[model samples]
Target chain A: MTAQPTQTGKIIISVDAMGGDSGPGVVVAGIAKSAKKNPEVGFLLHGPKDVLSKLVSKRRVLDGRVVFRDCPDVVTMQDKPSQVVRSGKNTSMWSALESVRQGEAHGAVSCGNTGALMALSMMRLRKLPGVNRPAIAILWPSRNPQGFNVMLDVGADVRADAKDLLQFALMGASYARNGMELTRPRIGLLNVGTEEHKGRAELKEAHALITDFADQANFDFVGFVEGSDIPGDKADVIVTDGFTGNVAIKTGEGTASLIGDLLREAFKYSPLSRLASVLAITSLQRLKKRIDPRRVNGGVFLGLNGTVIKSHGGADATGVSAAIKLAFTLAKSGFAEKLAARVASTAELEQDAAQSALQTK
Target chain B: MTAQPTQTGKIIISVDAMGGDSGPGVVVAGIAKSAKKNPEVGFLLHGPKDVLSKLVSKRRVLDGRVVFRDCPDVVTMQDKPSQVVRSGKNTSMWSALESVRQGEAHGAVSCGNTGALMALSMMRLRKLPGVNRPAIAILWPSRNPQGFNVMLDVGADVRADAKDLLQFALMGASYARNGMELTRPRIGLLNVGTEEHKGRAELKEAHALITDFADQANFDFVGFVEGSDIPGDKADVIVTDGFTGNVAIKTGEGTASLIGDLLREAFKYSPLSRLASVLAITSLQRLKKRIDPRRVNGGVFLGLNGTVIKSHGGADATGVSAAIKLAFTLAKSGFAEKLAARVASTAELEQDAAQSALQTK
Candidate 1:
């Protein structure tokens, strides 16, 4: 374990520079971009020192800001989560997470295998005091004034019981506060319908538990929200089991991409539409930027002992930078500690609520 | 129940002309549109006689095709499924379904509450022999050359066990063969991942059961598919529990609408872009037609004794016409009888497979 570095008015993010689809080049380039914009941010870059040094030396913005750790092992996309946890101690992903675990860095970011990263994170950071399972929270582009809504348990595991859902609500609310700067974010339980009697029995039980703990958790419980409400302003945080959340997120993305492709094809259908496309190129670029998945590229592992931002495996420089920026923001806000304390304080109340709700059922 | 109308050359469709958000006017106009194009189709219009008679009398296309059945009660959107089953006998929705049950009409279409419509259909028409649950299958615009993929169990029930999923596959395959004119539809069980070990326990059980029964059911079982594959060319039919299917459908719709609005806003951002919009309007309309929900407005109730198409509650004249056209197509092809036979014969195999899969687990 690395020694904890004293705070010196700067935030240090541990970056796993290997395992991403694009390799170490994009990760170093992304960190350089973030460093240029945020003078208060520094990086503990993890990978083979020789390779990372070559990339970092080419980028002037990275000068005096990157501390390289020599880690030759890489966790491939094919590696199972369990396999990685057992024999991946020397890998860059593990080393980067170690920096956060040891308190040497404020947080960790990886653009690697999601399952493996999540496994290593849970093994290394462990679950927060009472969290039965950790969740991965992502910021989805939405109709909210803030432009995004937080959805959790996107794929940490397939199932979430009533108690687990209550924990997700608290964690998601906390993330919304720190990540999106929302105060007392409105929370909604994701369901097939907004009606109380609708959805699976577990969802109904979770709804009651969340409602019972809403005031104590310092968030407004907006009750049930449907899939269409994911982008609507009806809820600030949508909570569900990983299975539904994962499917909904992917479905939304697939639909957006499909529509986007059709739009492009439509624009080039005829010579007249082609000329119009040129004239509207600038405005179209603006719209593209607004909905680009890269702008909200990171999925934060919540309910763990430390914060870990999982970038998309195929993220380019801009996407990686967005993830790094998120990690920096969370680190600067001391989000991990705040989240742990919040979960710890409410553990007892959540359990009581879950018990009563189940007993009544 | 009314006596079964003697089979004439024209196929008869029972239309619930009340209970839709737009009321009887849209229903009459929709039937008129369908009748204008298809002289072989006729309607058994169910609603209050004075209202429906006045509306139908004004439509020249429906002059000889419409037969009115007076049903004074309307099934409001707020009616619960159980409540509707208990005492909604005189409602237009019930009357419309009754026409199908009594064999007076080949099929039925309604734009009333989904839960209520499904309940009445299940109660009056009953489930096909050996079917544990009936599923609602919808056509989703996709990249397939056929331009659509069938997804089942979208909201008939919130949960589905292994055996129920097998039933959905069989029913969905029957629908694709009749409704979409596919010879042998490719069936994929919806899951979070393509891996066999992924998703919920029931999904794993379903994967095995579907695989075991695919040969006898006459559909190619493509195994597990992710949400992103819903619009992809990987499968012609995607089967899942109603809860997940419902959420994915709404999420897809929500995302497409959000992007469409953003594109419109972008095109109007500047005078240059506004000019571009005018030039692109024709192409845009073409694109809209390709993905219009109104074009595919009906959800077919599968595994029921009689086919019932549930149109969108808020469907306008065009949407209603699409639903009516779908009902006519299914009726003409004798889809209801085929689905019933398919489910009946395969039910024993499905149950045996489910038992084996469970015992192995």
Candidate 2:
């Protein structure tokens, strides 16, 4: 491998410059934004050297701060996870993840196919010990004082059983601590109701299991929380099966976008309304900043040996930069190591709880 | 039995006036608004005679348009469904459903505990001939020209198999035709992904089954849709199990409420924004009216012997009125009989499809 540009002692982020809806240029711009804001961060940009070089050379802030890797293949959104795992070695997404696997970068950031990224991530970085299923955790804007709550298993897999949910609680709590800097984050299992008897059969089982681990895990178990409580400050870490979590997140996002569109149309209905919009533009912008999905752009892959942050496929420069910032923070804090340690003890907790239950019986 | 004041040949509606969070006062006010706007509709108000009479007497429009049923008990929100089923015969919710069961009222409307109401509905009204599980269908604001789309199984039974989902599609299509007045409504099965192999095993089976029944059922099968399409224009009717549907709806509502609250806070942050708010009051009101959850407040119980509308428990008089309007429309259209006819033939269709599959095999 050729020696590339680097800043001594600066944290390096592996960036997949291809496969985003906005193309490689936007990815380059996003890394440049991060590079300008944080002088202590550099990038391992993976994509076509000819295209990436042109884009990187144009950004003055990125001078001597980026290492370019020539990865000619790109993973499309439509590619199946299984297909990508078998034949995607040359893709930018795979190459980017390779840097993290080889310890050449602190973490990897990609705006590629989510399923494929997760699949490649699992193959390249490997699952941490004691994790049956690795999960993707994202920050959801909430009524909490910290302004965001962590939700997990958003789209890692469609199904999660009772034991899986217990592990999610462990991982989510870890994320809330290291990622959000919360000392003792409260975990809530997502269900149809807060009542113990409500929801699927597995939820009742998961409830008991999560409650058993909370004390030892150093996080408070808030018990069951309904979907309405997701953004209502009931819990700092909302946990659920990926199918339900994915649906809930997308539904929330779709509703917000619809309202935003309607709000703009409402303001444009008349000349007087248009004038009001102009006057209130700053306030509207403030509101936009408060609830913007773009600000919380990264989905951190938990229960993995190396950190991987998945940015939204359609994320623009601002959104991508927000994701990079999140990746840098997690990498700097050694979030992957902490999360691995937390997950590694899950089996011990379960075995102890089981033994105590036998004694009580 | 007390004699009711009524206009000759007016449609009668069964209404639980006690179980709502707002009390009988709001229920009486709601029916009164309905009476004033719709002269051809009357109500059987179920509650304590003395208490309901006092509330109804204050509304001038309801002077001669309501029948009072002296049901003395009230079902609070905390009541268990099974407990209510065994011991709730005297409660207003049960009494209201009894009216629909005995054909005294065309349909039943309630703003009470959803589970209790659904249980009482099934026990009192019973399921249609071929439905394994009943569903609650609600109108969601969407980009369609009709301004809303229909979604089902919001909070009925949490579990729905492939056959149950097929029944939901038939019932949802019937609702769109009757409720939304769409001739041939398009139906989409909700999943985490639009891909055929992405969701649960049952979803794949339901997808094929829905596609098979679409043409004969008089609706277009739009195949699979993601949660984001719940508010999109991809389909007129979105179908899912009660657990997923309930989460999606509540998550959407919770997110919208949070955004609305944040928008208000943003406007209040500055004196300039305060001035802009005053100028944009009309535009803001216009926007509020367009997406007001209160305006679309009813969740219709499908595949039942009689129509039942479950309004939001926290709804005010306006939301109650919206539900009553829905009950009135469905009652006027003789929706129960049409839906019965549609569902009555589902078993036959399934049997025929089975025969065809056997022949092909």
Which docking band does candidate 2 fall into?
high
Q: Candidate 1 lDDT (Cα, whole model)?
A: 0.89
**DockQ of each model vs. true complex:** 0.81, 0.83
Worst 10-residue lDDT window, candidate 2 chain B: B1-10
Query: Per-residue lDDT for A153-207 in model 1, tens only?
Result: 8999999988889889999999999988999899999998888988888888888
lDDT for position A85 in model 1:
95
Scored by DockQ, the top model is 2
* DockQ for candidate 1: 0.81
**What is candidate 1's lDDT per residue for B214-242, written digit by digit as tens?**
88888999999988878778999999999
lDDT string for model 2 (A19-92, tens) is 99999999998998898899889999999999999999999999999989998899999899999999998999
Q: How would you encode candidate 2's per-residue C-alpha lDDT over B1-361 as one tens digit per residue?
A: 2213244788889999987888888888888888889988999999999998988888888888888889889999999999999999899999999888887888889999999999989988889999899999999999888999999999898899988898999999999999889999999999988888798988877887777778888899999998888889999999999999999999999999999999898778788888888888898998899889999999999988999999999989899999999998998887998899888876799657534534553
